[model samples]
Target: MNKVTTIDLGSNSFRVLIYDCLNHKIINEYNEVVGMADGLNETGNISLEAQERVVDAIMRSSKSLEYDPKSAVCVTTAAMRLASNSNDVLKYFEKTTGARFKIIDGKEEARLTLLAVKYALKRERIDSSKFILLDIGGGSTEIILNEGDNFNSKSFNFGIVTLTQKYLTSNKLIEELDNWKKEINLFLDELDINLEDFTFVATAGTPTTIAAIKLGQDFFHYDKDEVNGTIVNLKDLDESLEMFKNSNNETITKLVGRGRVEFIEVGIYIYKAIFEVLEKNESIVLDDGLREGVAIDYCLNKSI
Candidate 1:
């Protein structure tokens, strides 16, 4: 059996997925909500405290792998990619644990997101000629417009943590929303892409939260395969947003799924902005994206 584990070190969270290639199943998975991207706007760098937390988390996750440490592949995304001293942190990890981590660029991020969406959907053929692939991470968002297998993807620097630091926490949530809306509208107009040209397929925590809200759950279990193509309407999104915004930190933290309390508002803003821009009423959620995309790439390359 080919055994492999892929780790995604993101801005707000670190995820590890250990796979049994022969069975095409996940054997072990762990997620750590470590907001490494926080305070970037103020510090202009990742804080040393955050760095230490991430390094410790990575070390612990790495030790959980059934295979050799030398065999695991760790990739860092937006947070590490933009941090002024990201290379230093990477070097530290390499020196301490002998784990080499690669920083993936936006294009690669978008491409992997596409692969993950397709695999999650398990669609052999696509009937729609035009569709949008979206992944909203803690520190960035990748938007892809697909026509069949060929498409265009652009990664935006905007994300929950960045937006929150700039807008929400400052008591300027409405102002930030307006400005973001205008920015997205300008971009869409420049691309000459109309709302009718595509159907939205979103991945990541944001979409999943929307799914839980749509299902009326304060706490519930969600399956990626089950919710991959789930559709949520504007009304449900609005209600959820209101509920989340009205709640205090403790309340939001207790809502459902781990680590959403601090950033759920940003997730809502993302959904609201996208929907408002497109003049659409709903978004289809896809549970599979970047992580599974990593899995697919590893399997195809027989990297294990």
Candidate 2:
């Protein structure tokens, strides 16, 4: 039995997972908020502080991993792609830990996310004529369009963390949510998507956390079985947002936890806008994403 470890160096967080490929099970997983894209919008470069934090997180997670780095698949996404000092940071990481990281571009990111979601869809027995997958990360958002078995995608630079920080000081950010919906509508139009005919499948932290909150799953104990394939209604989501608006950061943290609570306000707006533009009243949440997709690909494509 081959044990495969995959690490997702996400913009908002760093995650490491060990999977039993033959058995199709995750043996161990660890996720930590490294905020690789923290203040990136303002700086146009990855800050020294953020880089240090990310390096520490990676080192700690690597220490806990059971598999070899030479064989493990390490993926770096949005934040690394956009950062001016990405090469230096990556080289430092590789030299320090002996783990080589591959920077997956936007289109590839979208494809992998859809691949993982499709796997989840099969696992859950959800049937649909066509389906679309969207992942809202810290530094970018990827939308995958699926017509039958064929897939294509569009990637946007805006994401929960970056979007929030971009408009943090705007007085009309809250009231201008509808305007953002129009922008997304225009973007979707450019992609020539047939939104009316396809089911919406959402991935990433925001949707999953929302599903968890709605199902009353606390931060200490989250069940993927309950979250994956979970349905999210826009009306209910609005209610949750309103509740968050009325509460303090401590309260919000208690609900969705640290790294996400800070971005939930913006993330909710993005979700609301997309669903409204697509005329989707609800979306099915999927817990699996790029990490799973990469791990599966490595296992299947490697030499037997």
Candidate 3:
């Protein structure tokens, strides 16, 4: 059946996706919030607690899935990139989990993400020659502009987890909103392309969560197929924010999944900011992202 597993060791979560290369279908999937970048903003290193969580998640998932850790295509993102002790952390993960994880730079991260998004667009039959792809991650945000055969991408350092740790957890999200928007705008302005001509598309947690909420689906009932290609309007996003704000801890967790209640607000804030800056009232949300891209890239390279 030619099944292969891909692990995305994200800053906020660890995701394992198994894909059948021969059939081009997903075999199984698992995700756990490890908060790998917890306190990374201040400590300049991944916390021992966070590292332990990752190792534990990896060990459990590897055992449950019965996948060879050495053969899995595992990639760590922004957290590892920014961590001062990433090498030590990587070695530790290898020793404990038997998984060798490669830390991908922001640009490479964007490229791999693009592959998945492109595949989704094609599968959904969304025909567009020009589009702007936004991926809001835990430690970095990547914006990619794809027009015909040309592509340009930029990665910003601040993301939901980092922003939450730096501001929201301190009750400063409101105070820091303007500055955050300005920083995002600065990066967008550099693209120097007329955004009006491009279709805005968003991937990753924020958009998918918004899509699920808009569809009235909670974590337990969340369906990726239904979420994919859903259009999220700005007004709906604002309303969702309000709903999240009013909801209690249990409700928020029920809606957004565990380990995400605290981060979702900051994530939505980032999502709204990007939409407003690009002058778009709505965006096409996709459920496919980096992990899917990794699997697809691997299969293509192997001619599977």
> TM-score winner among the candidates?
3
Ranking by lDDT: 3, 2, 1
Please list the residue runs of candidate 3 whose C-alpha ends up more than 4 Å from where it truly belongs after superposition. 169-177, 183-186
For 80-180, candidate 1 gives per-residue lDDT tens digits of: 88889988888887877666778999888887778767765556233446677668888888778877778777778888878877774535766766776
Q: What lDDT tens digits, residue by residue, belong to model 2 across residues 206-274?
A: 898889888988666788889998999897688888988899888788877777778887888878877
The 0-to-1 C-alpha lDDT of every candidate, in the order given, reads 0.74, 0.81, 0.89
**Global fold similarity of model 1 (TM-score):** 0.88
Which prediction has more favorable TM-score, 2 or 3? Answer: 3
TM-score of 2: 0.92
Q: What is residue 85's positional error in candidate 1, in angstroms? A: 0.5
Error of 1 at 1 (Å): 1.5
Q: TM-score of predicted model 3? A: 0.95
Off by over 4 Å in 2: 169-187, 190-193
- Candidate 1 structure lDDT: 0.74
Candidates' TM-scores? 0.88, 0.92, 0.95
